[model samples]
Target: MQVEYQAPLQRLNTFGIAARARCLVRVRSEDDVRALLRQPGWDWQHTFILGGGSNIVLAGDVQRTVLKVEIPGRRLLREDERGWLVEAGAGERWHDFVVWTLQQGWPGLENLALIPGTVGAAPVQNIGAYGVELQDRFHSLDAIDLETGETFTLHHEHCAFGYRDSVFKHDRPGARGMGLRGRALITRVRFWLPRRWRPELSYQDLQRKVAETGIQQPSPWQVLEWVCAIRRAKLPDPAVLGNAGSFFKNPTVTAEQCADIIGRDPRVVHYPMPDGSVKLAAGWLIDACGWRGKTVGRAGVYEKQALVLVNRGGPQDPCSGGEVMTLARLIQTSVYERFGIRLEPEPVCVG
Candidate 1:
């Protein structure tokens, strides 16, 4: 509960943006959070909940008191006839947790390996990779109500999980509103790992690995290894090149719209969703608009993956969040002008 004034945040964010929090508090436990909430004249609305800082862009120094979550723990809460229930503190690194589960013979999370950020941030974005989303394995979560200073729990339905979205990403005024965006702080997350597990290779990248290796029946650990390798080759390492992984969500279009786009451009990359909608590769769209390997100010699109935007200036002269947003806006405008589809940024921007 120690409050540090004017805390340096350059190293805190994966983007390596030079910024500082006006006031910062590192919450290592639920007691720390409760103590902060009980402070005299404290205002939760004037606070910002920061996790690993992986899915955020800081335009400038944050004015709000930043609550840096660092709660850490991992355990198998229950091993029932149904499945194994595992829980992790909000602050635990997501990739590390995934690997830990596999090491413990819990294989449900293998497909989501190598994603940046912490367990708490997973539900906020409904993070998905290699054909498995967080909600697919989520059991429940414990969180604190920022306004009430009380703790509560939310199951998958209460979370309102969607593709890269959840109630935590929204803001609603009334208590009954579905959105919980700025009103709650997650402290712990639990996952239900099935007793029987199967490898998910629906994602094209994993399929390619199967083809190259000629291994039809891959184990969960094997799938994890393949996912890590594919991500390493495609995505730029944040430690080397500052980036927020995929910069945009794959836009879903109607079958008719897909046909129209294909008729115009024969090589458009797309896949059919189970719901019958067509999911277009946002990277393909950006490349079609000629944005790959392009730069704007100190921000640039990654040469390896068009979906990722990187800070070309490096740590010494890192790109500001404004530069990233500017480039994002330019890409969005061009994609919309050419393809009649708007590109939505994935990261939350703050200043």
Candidate 2:
């Protein structure tokens, strides 16, 4: 374990936001995490757990002890005639895990290729792309209770996942049903992947890509490559620039509401949800509101992707202090005014 006081968080988050944590600790194992949690001097109220920092925005300075999880390991825990169950530590990079599965000829997670985040956070958000979601493969996870310093296993049902949300995101007040409001810290996750090949080509983008490529049944590697290519072209690279991909979640509304919006604007595109709801493209709504490529002070929406908010320049670079909440408020207000649907931010915000 490594501990530091008044540590800079600019390099820790994908946005490169300039912020400072009063105390920061890096834990490499479950035992290290439990030891820190058991310390009486450590302020549990002012402690926060962080993974890859890919889906967060640091507003200003955080006066908390930000625990950066670094536990690293992967293993095949179990296997059956149908699939294999694999376990990964919380600190593992999500993309690396996907690549590892692909190399092993496992066939699930190909559509989620190139997503930027840690494995631990995947279950929290039920991270999805193309036509698949983390929940489809998630088996269980191990989390440590911040208040008790005790670990417990959370099964798929206990997670109560709902479209980019789970027990880890909303278990606390104001978490919007994303279970991990502020109480639990994930340490490991388990996923089950099929032993045989089973491809999903439901998302319009993926289907279009397949049609354009003239491949009726694309291999897992080919599908992953296509998804990666599309993401690379659409979303800005956070390493080169500063950004957390897709600042907002696509708003899901009733089919009636979707019809109303479409009647008002024929160009509105919507995807049918499982429960008789329609998922609207938040990017489309923002673009219709003329927010695409729009800039306010140093914060601006990415020109190529309306859903992404970029720092333009590095944090503390003058061109880097755009208030994410302000931009998000604008988007929410505009979408609500135009379509009566509120846009919710997907990234975790800290101050």
Whole-model Cα lDDT of every candidate shown, in order:
0.93, 0.85
> Listing every candidate in turn, what is its Cα RMSD in Å to the true structure after a full C-alpha superposition?
0.9, 2.3
Among the numbered candidates, top TM-score falls to: 1
lDDT of 2: 0.85
**Deviation in Å, model 2, residue 348 alpha carbon:** 1.4
How good is model 1 by TM-score? 0.98
Q: Looking at candidate 2, what is the lDDT of residue 303? A: 95
Q: Which lDDT tens digits does candidate 2 get at residues 286-307?
A: 9999999987767789999898
Residue pairs clashing in model 1 are none
Show how many residue pairs clash in every candidate, following the order shown. Answer: 0, 11
Name the 10 consecutive residues with the lowest summed lDDT in model 1: 172-181
Total backbone collisions, model 1? 0
> Which residue ranges in model 2 land beyond 4 Å of their true spot?
172-180, 315-322
